[model samples]
Target: MAISIDRISKSYGEHKDVHALREISLSVHTGELFGLIGPDGAGKTTLFRILTTLVLPDRGSATVEGKDVRDDFRDIRTMVGYMPGRFSLYQDLSVEENLRFFATIFHTTIEENYELIKDIYVQIEPFKKRRAGDLSGGMKQKLALCCALIHRPKVLFLDEPTTGVDVVSRKEFWAMLQQLKKQGMTIFVSTPYMDEATLCDRIALIQKGSIMSVDTPENLLNKYQGDLWGIRTEHMYKALQDLNNFPSVTECYTFGAMHHAQVSGLQMPAELHNYLDRKYHKNIRVEKIKPTIEDCFMQLMQADEREPVPNE
Candidate 1:
């Protein structure tokens, strides 16, 4: 295992008691591109900090590359690269200067580890003299990645690396990750985008500081329990509310312009159409659709809501 977490928990504030993480446990295999898929405040950042040895867990244990995070903080720090959620590089320094500074901190020259970051560095090299703060979001992302890899660590940890970048840049960033994975780097990345979940080798869907489920994207979709139908009409909003009030509707939510409804029994398009005709009296279309990663995530969240929480 490249990373191992067991029953890890963390909290914030003494009196207010904000539980940041709750009994989280998961593992990342060596050379795997794993993802922590969740929205903000889901404890992804907290878990990453713990794994990178920047913060201590309130309970449980974690290990990176067979070294204990608590007992071997120094060793772990050297063996892994961390790119925090926020842009943490020296904004005043030139692009190349920032890279050089990180390389110096690791006691290695740019020439020594240039091969590790050459592909990423070359993209931002044209702006080598540009201040880090002056670069665009995509350029800053590449620069940050280059700095993190300057030392050629075996494992890479990236937190929300594509949060504010353009769509093209986001696609390019994932392509870069694919290249890194080919070079035998164990990558652990966190993202709030549900579509990005499918790109990972495996993903842990987390919410409210607790893990909902962990599995390959394909497997998660395969485990979807019921048939899903897409309903679209001129009155989308009202139709959504009406579908939610339907007796047979198990789950109803909006996806783009259409509303996806999961029904309990084998009700075809005609039944749905007839039901809508009787109520809304509008020309509505209902088609059976395949469930997506977002659908699986929504189902997991609903299941979590029904689960009972233990007493402290």
Candidate 2:
């Protein structure tokens, strides 16, 4: 395994404890692109910090490339490249200076690893002389990736790299990540966007501090609970309550542009349409729709709320 975590846990507070991670255990295979998928405050950063040797976990153990994060902190620090969620480059320093500074810390010059970063660095090369603080959001992200790759570390950890970038930049950034993965580098990345989950080789869905599920995107989608139907009426808000109260609806919630109702086997689209038609609803549309990662996440969250998951 490139990364292995065992029953890791962390909490903060003096009088009242606030848990950030609860017995989180996950494994990333060698040279694999693994993603930590969740919403904000899901302990993604806490796990990253533990693996990167930035902070010690209050419980459990972890290793990166067979080196213990606690006992081999120095070796792990030198062997892994980490790009934090928030931009952390020296804002006053020019792009080139920031890159050079990071390169020097690993006892290597920009020339030594220039080839590894060329594809991404070239995008921001034109702004190499610009102060880090003056660059656009996308440009800043590019520079950060450059600095992180400048050392040519064995394992890469990126925390929400596309959080604040433009849509085009986000697309470009993932493309760059695909290129990097092709080069055989192990990457562990985290993002709150459910849409990004499908881009990963495998993802761990996390909420609060616990991992809800771990599987390939396809496998997760295949496990979506019940038959899903995309439903829309002239009055969406008013119909929401009606849909939820419908005897055949196993689950009902508004999902972008329409309400998604996971109905029981006894209900058909036409039956649902007729039921709503009797209520004087107009322009009703009910179609069985494919579920997305967001839908899977919602299902997991609802299940967790109904019954507490036993720790493994």
Q: Count the backbone clashes (under 3 Å) in each candidate.
A: 0, 0
Cα TM-score per model: 0.97, 0.97
- Model 2: per-residue Cα lDDT over 174-266, one tens digit each: 999999999999999999988888999999999989999999999999998787899999999988989888898877899989999877675
Candidate models: Cα lDDT each: 0.91, 0.92
**List of clashing residue pairs for candidate 2:** none
Residue 234 miss distance in model 2 (angstroms) = 1.0
Worst 10 residues of 1 by lDDT: 303-312
Which predicted model would earn the best TM-score? 1
Q: List candidate 2 segments past 4 Å from native.
A: 309-312
Candidate RMSDs in Å, in order, are: 1.1, 1.6
The Cα RMSD of model 2 versus the native structure comes to 1.6
Residue-level lDDT of model 1, residues 1-312, one tens digit each, is 999999999988985278889999999999999999998899999999999999999999999999999999999988899999899999999998999999999988899988888888888999999999999889999999999999999999999999998899999999999999999999999999998989999999999889999999999999998889999888888888888888888889999888999887765678888888878558789999999888998888988889864533
